[model samples]
Target: MEGCKRLEQLPKSIGSLSCLTNLNLSHCDRLANLQIHILEQPSPLESGLQRRKIIVHLPGEINKLSSLVNLSIDGRIHIQLLNLIGDAEHISCIPKQQTPDELLLSRCYVLKSLNIKRTRYNKDGSSFSCISFSDFHSLTELKLINLNILTIPDDIGQLQSLEKLDLSGNDFKSLPTSMTNLSRLKYARLSNCIKLVALPELTQLQTLKLSGCSNLRSLLNLSHAFHERVRYGLLELGLDNCRNFKSLSYQVRQLTSLIHLDLSRHDFEEIPESIRELSSLGTLCLNNCKKIKSVKDLPESLKHLYAHGCDSLENVSLSSNHSIEKLDLSHCFGMKQDEHLITQILNDGFSQVVCFLNNYSLVN
Candidate 1:
């Protein structure tokens, strides 16, 4: 009964419909109780409780829906009690927990995608044991963000059908080596995982984002995973604000197909000379890289270069026949002081370039 704004509850007798395959209770703002109805469900193939503002509890009786195939409970409402069951293909829930209990996920045998976001931290430091993910054979995408997860089981690699994984804002120090076995995994985002110290070789990934992982010290495994034959598959890599990661130069030379690279907030004094090897690189971000004094040895394929807020930048060398379409050196104090540097930049065969210098811009 969707759009039933005043519907307060489902009758307990309604559960007797053994063949009930679909139940949609969307936009039911006053409906608050489903404990009795859910506990008696003999068989339900689909159930949706969307936009129910007063429904905050999903009692353990939901596990009784043995034949349920698809379940979706969406809205801005926060769930106070969560119970997972059935052979559902897709599941999404936001639960307030001290420690996210992965053991509850063991029952989703045929699940395809799961996203669980923890809304609070555990003050008592109590948590359930991690369960093996090997049973989720049909699972393709999994996102468990900000759950204070220290690690995951090795059986995670057994998810042969998995493609995308996002564990951003978690507390993982490292990942299991078995993750490399996911041949079809294309995207992985670990942004803001401040405690993450390392990662396994996931060469099959086309996009890897690690924007705020400050403790990470090396990326040798990621680089070593690629060779001349397969390196061209990786298209995007983000390492912005990864302060201690210094193994960028040599490893980047291998990603011949990289189109976008973010090196913002790094302490490097110069752009890696090996960057010129990225023949497919189009966008390069060096914003707030204050230590870099000169810009040179750029890739000929670079279309956009962002070095804004680079206060120490003084000299910039661009080839006469280069393919650069835009260059941003805004807020570079050193460049504004050197009149010769400014004059040299204007005469560097940039007749068709759009350049941003200090507070002004030049579009020739």
Candidate 2:
């Protein structure tokens, strides 16, 4: 649909094509109305026009496309296919140019995964704030990045089959209590949400990444999530660059199934020996923890250890039979270890870990 500058409307009978499956009105500069009720599942209908946008004003027909399962459209097209779409399992709609007020998903009841992300990410660009999220109980994964949403509807707790959720780069301040209902949810990424301040309780969560948030002061009720997920099995947590995080209210000793943890660039001083309860712990990074003074009760399952810039670090506990691979103690001026213990670690594990760390051992 290129160079059709005078095209204003399509024949109204176009919606009567009960067997019509494909529609490509992309790049149509002057096209304004599309009276189509696609019967069969249409293929990816791309409307990515680099020069001019193809305008398609949808009519108020709720029963129009009752059979559309997949409809991929790009470019700035103002159309509402929500109420007209019922039982769709997958849906993607991208209007790369304009920021519409609402993205209605109240009609896709059986949808398993829904993504409404920006065609491109811009730090200062505008994003949709108002959205209709309802009746999508069967959703398993939901990614709505760059939608300057300030709050998630409490009804989101209705997604019982949800496994993953990515709401990065949004404007939410507090998560809904409804998310406490996602029993099967395992992964959540909330990076770059600058206004986010809190999270809800999760039962079976395994991985939670809060990397770029700036105002988050704490992980509210983390003990509940830790207790529930640890009972369910292994998990991972990352708290990188969350500059305002000031406390961990949860009991750390009970997290036996935690496999990976990142507490880099924080102001904490001591790591409790209860950390030894992590039988599955493999990677531990304490880089730049300037005030840390001792390290003991290291877990046997540990495979990598990095404490490169801990200026006051003095003691490091090691077992001859541990599975440790690499230990970075660079710039740790206060650490003192027996030469014999180093020989034992080298004998049981690969030479790379021992020799690499040995170069930084002090001359005491």
Question: Which candidate comes out best when scored by TM-score?
Answer: 1
TM-score of each: 0.68, 0.63
What Cα-based lDDT does every candidate model obtain? 0.67, 0.61
- How many residue pairs clash in each candidate at the backbone level? 1, 0
Off by over 4 Å in 1: 1-109, 118-130, 222-232, 337-353
Winning model by lDDT: 1
lDDT per residue (tens digit) for residues 175-253 in model 2: 9888877888899989888888877655467888777787887664655554454344337877766668644525445
Alpha-carbon lDDT of model 1 = 0.67
Question: Alpha-carbon error at 275 in model 1, in Å?
Answer: 0.4
| lDDT, model 2 | 0.61
